[model samples]
Target: DAGVTQSPTHLIKTRGQQVTLRCSPKSGHDTVSWYQQALGQGPQFIFQYYEEEERQRGNFPDRFSGHQFPNYSSELNVNALLLGDSALYLCASSLANPIYGYTFGSGTRLTVV
Candidate 1:
């Protein structure tokens, strides 16, 4: 089965502009988790969606939000973005029961000017 995949391997935006990144989860998976991995740092959990509802969240502002589609894919949206928001946005997928670990996509590198 195809693992998770993200679009626009890289992105560039201004400090106050917004951006939207997309993701497709692996087969047989219904949960999608978004993560932010800054340079030289571990991926930080942004939020997770299961059954189209947010099941978990991390320490991030409202500027960071997401949505899960019925097809089990997802999108992360950042509003009023700041320079600090620039980072590698990753999407990970796992089983609902989560007996196994998550599978991550290569990620979309975002740079803010």
Candidate 2:
């Protein structure tokens, strides 16, 4: 079974530009969650999507949004990016409610220039 995968393993953006990162979940999974990890910090939950709808959202700003497709893949979109947005964007997949350990893809290192 194919595991989760993310595009543009690394990305660079300016302070005000918008960026979109993509993710494909593991085979047979239906839930996808996004996390942000700052240098020296643990990954912070941004949001989670299931059944093509957002199921849970973290304390991130309105500028952070996401979408999950019927295929169980997902994309994270960030607008009016700030320098603080520079971090590792991680995507994790689970079978259902995420009570189980997640399968995490290699994160996309985003740098706000």
Candidate 3:
């Protein structure tokens, strides 16, 4: 009965650098979604992965990319990182779609210094 799990609880990157964050969804979940949360702000949807394909995307630059594996694990990759990319990266898992709600992890704290 493992819940959502995110790797590298914290990350530090330099401007122009690239980083990848990994996530393993909760048991029984098949859809994964990524979000960016800034201080005092609600989470902003980054993208969603289902059936190993990107199903939906939010307002973000091409620098942000993602991948989903057959086992329902996922990865979020950010390239040419900017200081503005500093935020909390969250991974949420749902049964088949997000409309039913999601179970989230603590998130990865990314600091772009």
lDDT of each: 0.94, 0.95, 0.96
The deviation in Å at residue 81 for candidate 1 is 1.2
Q: Which candidate has the top score in lDDT?
A: 3
Better of 2 and 3 by lDDT: 3
lDDT digits (tens) for residues 40-110 of candidate 1:
99999999999999998999999999999999999999998898998999999999888889999999999
Candidate 3 structure lDDT: 0.96
Per-prediction TM-score to the true structure, in the order listed:
0.97, 0.96, 0.97
Ranking by TM-score: 1, 3, 2
Stretch of 10 with least lDDT, candidate 2: 92-101
TM-score of 2: 0.96
Q: Candidate 2: misplaced stretches above 4 Å?
A: none
On TM-score, the stronger of 1 and 2 is 1
Error of 1 at 15 (Å): 1.2
Candidate 3 clash pair list: none
In candidate 2 the C-alpha lDDT for residue 28 amounts to 80
